[model samples]
Target: MSEFQTKVSPDSETFARNRKDMLALVERMRALEARAAAKSEERRPVFDKRGQLSPRERVSALLDPGLPFLELYNMASYLVDDPDPDTSIPGASIILGIGYVEGVRAMVFADDAGINAGAMTQKSVDKALGAIAIAERQKLPFIHLVESAGADLMRYTVELWAHGGGMFAGLARLSAAGIPVITVLHGASTAGGAYQPGLSDYVIGVRGNGMAMLAGAALVQAATGEAAQDADLGGAEMHAATTGLVEYLAANDAHGIEIAREVVSGLGWKACGPALPVCAEPLLPPDQIAGVVPVDYRTPCDMREVAARIADGSDLREFKPDFGPATLCLQARIMGQPVGLIGNNGPLDPDGAAKATHFLQAMDQAGTPVVFLNNTTGYMVGTASERAGMIKHGAKMIQAVTNLRVPKITLYTGASFGAGNYGMCGYAFGADFLFTWPNAMTGVMGGAQAALTMEQVARRTAERKGVEADEARLAAQRAKITAHFDRQSDAFYTSGRVLDMGMIDPRDTRAVLGFCLHTCQEARARQLNPNSFGVARI
Candidate 1:
């Protein structure tokens, strides 16, 4: 294995510019995340008065100390409600991720009840379903810190109503698949939300704060003229004693989390096998990664520089270095886990696509997990490329990426555009965990190129109609389209729309990839007994 030599210069003008741009993007991400946190913090006083923990505080207390919590989809609904970037916060009113609970790794979902009473919006439902899908696929136990006001009626959509059933179905599937579902009702869980705790294998209810009912008092009265108090209907005490909906009752939020942790500790679920081999740290400082990627994606840089900072010992075994110089394929290790790396130095040419196709098949044959570094404009165009069978070769590469059985992780390091996004295992391709750098952009094509394309179309249409083209109007339209695309292509915009799992700092790339790789590896090794139907309360 040869080490990838460094080509990035810290003092170079490009590096300096990239560092400044990267830092700015990072700040934007941090600001958005802080806004979401601040929104929750605003309710801290109310929670303290009620002797209850905030949603985030509850999550922190639920996980084991000194363990990493990989929060996912933190920007799920960003900029969706309003056009103003300053006011739109995008976490879908839920904090979800993977973390250690009593030494066992589990999927944790906590409703940000402090924000809008933890109302379930369309984005929140999508985020929940994504978490459920991950839990099911990874064979991880699902732990939900329930405290939702159910779906928002004001923003309701028929699509959300149709997809809401998947949440419950996913829960049942997880249980039947032998993955435990545990829930702690931290506060109100009314209407459809009540089923969350009901479907769980283990339920812990906080004595004074917990509430779960198919219909609240007002709703019950409206429907059947039956008078019922909140506590008598579905409070913690009632559920534990009368309905048997809750297996455990705790005095408060901390006690409830502790009880939930204890249940996980008692599950008898042991680690799959021995610890992984010791891995050497990368020779290059990971911090330098900020300068490795050009701030302007059009600028050319070696993708290997990224691999150097993230690969264990900065060692990489290049595959087919000459056959497809643009598409780089290599065998590398991250935290002692063997993985295949696929990255782009330029657009996917016919040869590059062919090389990638072959490389993916080989990696799959070797049963190695693959990581894709997406930084491509797309497949090369022009008559020469078409004559070179670009379409056929690109399709072959996409097919290989689509069919590979190994765990695939994708990182949007730079430009991800055109069919190149698809060929590089974009979100639609279902990368096990797709993460993007703060400076990343994802769209069909560059804003300028798309705008110019439309302008050409408009001009051609006018010419065909024997009318003079309105150059001023065309220019304005092009500018508008370019601005729109530029805004939409931003990492924050894509992240808010749940495009990638979340936007991560460039320096944290290795750690994030290693954590996900370990998770995927564990899931592949863990065995579970499946039943036709999930266990139901008797």
Candidate 2:
């Protein structure tokens, strides 16, 4: 293995500018995350008055102490509810992530009942489905902190109603796969929401607060002219004693979470496999990554520099280095876990595409996981490049990525444009896990190019119709299109919309990669006892 040498000049003007821009982007992300937290905090008084813990508080208390919790899609529905961005809080009235419960790594999600009475939204439903997909794929145990008023009818749509069934289907799938599904009802879980806990293998409900019913007392009386109390309808005590819906009844939120932890502890999950090879930290300081990647996506930087900063001991064995320099393929170890890495120094030419395809296949043959450090304007275009078979080669690369059996992880270090996104295993390619840098941008192409293309189309249409082209109108239209695309392509916008999980600081790249790699490895090694149907309550 050849040691990668760093050529980045930290004191250079360009590096300083890059560092400043990257830090500012990171700051913006932090502020947005803080805003979401603050919004949830605003309901603290209400939760306290009800003798319950906040959604975040419940999550914290449920997880093991000193364990790393990777929260996914923390900003799911930002700016979706209204026009004003400030008024829209992102989290989709839910909190979801992977964390340790009783030493067992599991997928845990909680209803943010503190927000909008834990009403379900389109994005929240998507986020929940995404979380469930991860848990199902990784064979991780599923845990839910159920507290929801169900779907909000005011803003509900037929699409949301139709897609809502997937949530229940996912729960059943997880249980059928022999992965335990645990639920703790901390508050209301009415109507369709009742199935969330009902489908779980184990359920714990808070005595005074927990409720799960198809219809509340008011609805029962309104429909049948029979007055009934909530306690008789779906209260925790009723479910635990008579309905056989809840397995355990707790006095409060803390007790419910405690019981959940205990249930996970009793699962008898196997321990993780043997550790990877011992390796030293990267010789290059990971902190330098902030300066290494320019904020401007157009500015070129060596992807190898990023490889060096993340690889253990800065050792990366280049594979066919001279054949295709732009698309770098290398073998390196992150935290002693060997991995094949594909990165970009420029657009994917025919040669680069072929090289990457070969590299992906070789890695799969070797049973090594691959990590994509994405940064490209996509495949090289134009008459010369197209003549060189760019489309054929790019398709081959995409095919290799799509068919690979190995776990694929993607990190958008910079611009991920055009089919380069697919070739590099973007979200559509079903990466085992995907994350982006605070400065990353993902779209079909840059905003400027898209605007110009639309402008040309409009001008050509006017000419074909024998009408004089309106130059001023075309210019104004182009400006609007450009601005919209630019805003939509921003990292904040993409991340908020759950484009690729969530954004991370450049400095934390190695640690995050190492954590995810280990997770994938453990999942691949573990075995499960599947049944024809999921375990059900009597």
Candidate 3:
């Protein structure tokens, strides 16, 4: 394998300009993430008065000291909650991430009760389910710091109740699949929320604070005219002694977290993977990635240049290069771990699609993780491409990606448009950990193309109606359409809507991918012990 030569010059004016633009986007992303934490901080007095730790504090206390925590969807429900993207509260009232606890890796979900009393929102449900999927795929333990206000009745939607059941169902499935699920009730877990800890392998209820009940006092009185205190109905003490639901009762929030940590430690869990070879630092610096990748995605740049900075020793063994010049399949090592990488040079034609399909199958056969550096206008469209079996070849690539036996990680680094998004492991395609760069754009098509397409359609319709096409009106319409597409395609906007995990600076790509691939490899190597059902009360 030959070392890739650097094409970008940090001293060049273009590189400087791109780096400046990229840093601005990174700053904007940081501010949005900070805003979520700041919003929760505003309710610190409420949490302090109640003698409770915030959701974040619980997660920190549960995880091992000073370990990296990969937070997911920090901007969830940002614009969805309010029209203003800047001032909106994200995280959907829940904190979700993967972190090491008691020296064992696990997924943690904590309800941000400091925000809206931790009411379960639509995106909040989606975020929790997403975390569960990652845990199941990665074969990691699941830990939940529970404190939710059930569902938001005022902002009611039928879909919220419908989709929210998946979280509890996921907990049951994880336990049945031999994955540990530890849930700690730090405060209220009312109505349907009770099933959360009920399905877990281990349940810890914090005394004087934790509450899990099928019906609260008001609900019980309204339904059957029975008068009973909520504490008597389903407090930690009641459940611990009467129902046998609380496996461990804690003195407080901090105590509950300590108990959860002990349970994880007692599981006798450890991760094992193939011994990695000594890794070499790439000749390129990670800081140079901002300069190497064009801030303006429309400006053509070789994705191989970006790969060079991340690949160990800047060496990528190119596979079937001449066959599909536009679609690249490169075998390389990142942070001492081997990976089969797919990067797009342009729109995917039949040959490119076929080549990518073959590459994916080969990687899966070898049990190597696949990383898609998506930067495509999409699958090629036209009579020439159609005649070459574009649809059939492209379908093969999609099928291969969909059925990949190996871990699939996607980075929306650049332009990811149309069916190309689907073919390259888009959000819906189950990429174990899909992410994006701040400069990335994803949609059915680019803004200019989409606007031109609609304008053409309008002009044709006008001509068919025996009316002269109004140029001024069409121009205005095209501009409007372009703005609409551009707004939605932005990485920040789509990320806030819970598109990818969240945006990252281009410079951090190597570190992020290395961490994710390491986790995936651990899952593949570790074995689980299963039973007929999850650990249940006997």
In TM-score terms, candidate 1 sits at: 0.98
Candidate 2 wrongly placed segments (more than 4 Å) = 458-470
lDDT of each: 0.91, 0.90, 0.88
How close to the true structure is residue 523 of candidate 3, measured as C-alpha lDDT?
Answer: 90
Ranking the candidates on lDDT from highest down gives 1, 2, 3
Q: What's the lDDT of the predicted structure labeled candidate 3?
A: 0.88
Give one clash count per candidate, in the order shown. 0, 0, 0
TM-score attained by model 2: 0.97
What TM-score goes with each of the models?
0.98, 0.97, 0.96
Candidate 1 at residue 484, lDDT?
Answer: 88
Candidate 1 structure quality by residue, lDDT tens digits, 238-259: 9999999999999999999999
By summed lDDT, the worst window of 10 consecutive residues in model 3 runs over 269-278
The deviation in Å at residue 250 for candidate 1 is 0.9
User: Model 2 clash pairs?
Assistant: none
For candidate 1, the 10 contiguous residues with the lowest summed lDDT are 268-277
